[model samples]
Structures are given as structure tokens and as C-alpha cells.
Target: MRQIKIDYRRPNPVPQPAPRPAPAPNQGRPPVRGGGTEHPGKTRRCNRHPGVHMVLAGYNTEWNTVRYLCPMCHAMGLPPVEVATGVINAYFPEKGYGFIENGGPRIFFHLSDLATRFTPQLGMPVTCRVEANDKGLIGREVTPR
Candidate 1:
């Protein structure tokens, strides 16, 4: 009978590759005020309340831009408007339509109804003159405050 001798030695561990270094700050586009590019699903600082981050409240269109709201501003409301004061509840830049929240029902508005050339954003404070039409309440002469 022939007996075979077996060596019980462990093999040496394989070397791992070094991790890649992180990208430089603001490598490409201009640095955002907060130090990074705006990302989807990330909260942004409120224009009215710089210290507060806005929340995603709702979306007007199925695939359009999502709307944002400031908890403090929404709760406290903006300054009184001779006609009506409200926040831009929803805005669809592509579709040229949006809604305003003025304490009652949402007031419908359109790009043509806007008195200013600047575009409207969600949660923007605005003043509007509301008028009743066959379709319902519509906002006219809408201007950002």
C-alpha cells in the first residue's frame, strides 16, 4: 500500500485594486449656491424663506415639473392682496398653465394671464385678480410678489 503525503498550507490572499478618487468640486457646470448641482427628489431652499428647505407638495401634469411648498409660508400665508394674494400652487411651463392657492378653491391661470415676463415657479408668492367664467374661477393679471 502506497501512502500519499498532503501539505495543509493556506494560500496567500490576492491584492485588491485601489479605490478611485472622488471628482473635484464644481468640475463641470457652475457650482450651485449650495455647492452641488440640483438633483431630482432633493429638497431646495425656499426663495421666500432662505433658511427653510421647500417640500414637494404636488405635481400639476403627469410628467411635468413637480411643485414645491414652504411649510412656514403656506401655514402663515403671504401679505394681504387688494385683489387676492396666493401662492403658485402648480405651474406647467411647457403647457403654459398653472393653479394658485388663495385660501378657497385652486384658481386656474395661464401664461397669457401673467402680467410679468418672468416665469412662475411652484410656491412663488403672487397677487392676482380673480374672475368667474363659464369654466370656473380664473386668475387674471397674475403678478409675482
Candidate 2:
């Protein structure tokens, strides 16, 4: 003779929140007035820096919510170069280097471009950004769409 028993004390899992809508042509905020270094309700600042001004409103693919891309970050307290004008002089594929004609020495780019559709042109008017990483500067998404 054989006997078998089953226990039923385990609790049901919690339901996660609903995800946001995506696959949008342009789903973000319009440009605000007086876009500069100072964000809303911030005491610390520097007048010299005019932090990065991004036109696109980003949604965190991870959290699935719309979050603004700060030109710099909160740690700096000072603003970033929100508005920048320059050109991509060369793209050295062999050396994994890129140069900006008018931008400074730190001005370089590495293309792990997630936005695969974005094809950059050399010596073209590039109104984009360089995000801060461990290596220092990394170019981000482009604008004027």
C-alpha cells in the first residue's frame, strides 16, 4: 500500500501595473518657454552652464514611463550645454573614433546607436548630444525630426 499527500499553503502572486502605450510617431511634450540650466524647484545652479535642451520626451523602456532627458545630471547641480551646434568631421571605424569639427577635445562619439534608423552623415549639421558615461562622453540620439 502507498500513500501520497499534497500541501496547498502557497499564496498567489501580485499583479503588476499596466504598461504605457508605444510605437508612436511622436509622443512627447512640446518645447517649454525659457529652456535653460535651471529646472523646476532647484536651488543650486551656475549661470555659465546652459544645460542640454532635448526636444524629445523619452519613455523609460524599463519602467515604461515618460521621463525627460536632463542634458547633464543632478549630481553636477550646475546645468549642461542644452543647446549645441556643431558638425561630425570624421568617423574612424578602425579606431572607433569620431570627431566634431567645432566641438572641443572631449567631443567624440561611439555608435551603439539603438535607434538603428538614425544614419549620421559626415561634415553635416549635427544637432545632437554626448551623454556622460564612465569613458566620459558618449553621443546620444539625434534631433530636428
Candidate 2, residue 46: the lDDT equals 26
- Sliding window of 10 residues with minimal summed lDDT for model 1: 32-41
Highest lDDT model number: 1
How well is each residue in 6-27 modelled by candidate 1, as lDDT tens digits?
3322132121234336658645
lDDT of 2 by residue, 1-145 (tens): 6443323221221212344455365534432233222231222222233454433344333322223444455355643423233467777767655754433434466565323455556765553444555665455543221
Give the per-residue Cα lDDT of candidate 1 at 45. Answer: 58
Clashing pairs in model 1?
none
Off by over 4 Å in 1: 1-82
For candidate 1, the TM-score is 0.43
Error of 1 at 141 (Å): 0.6
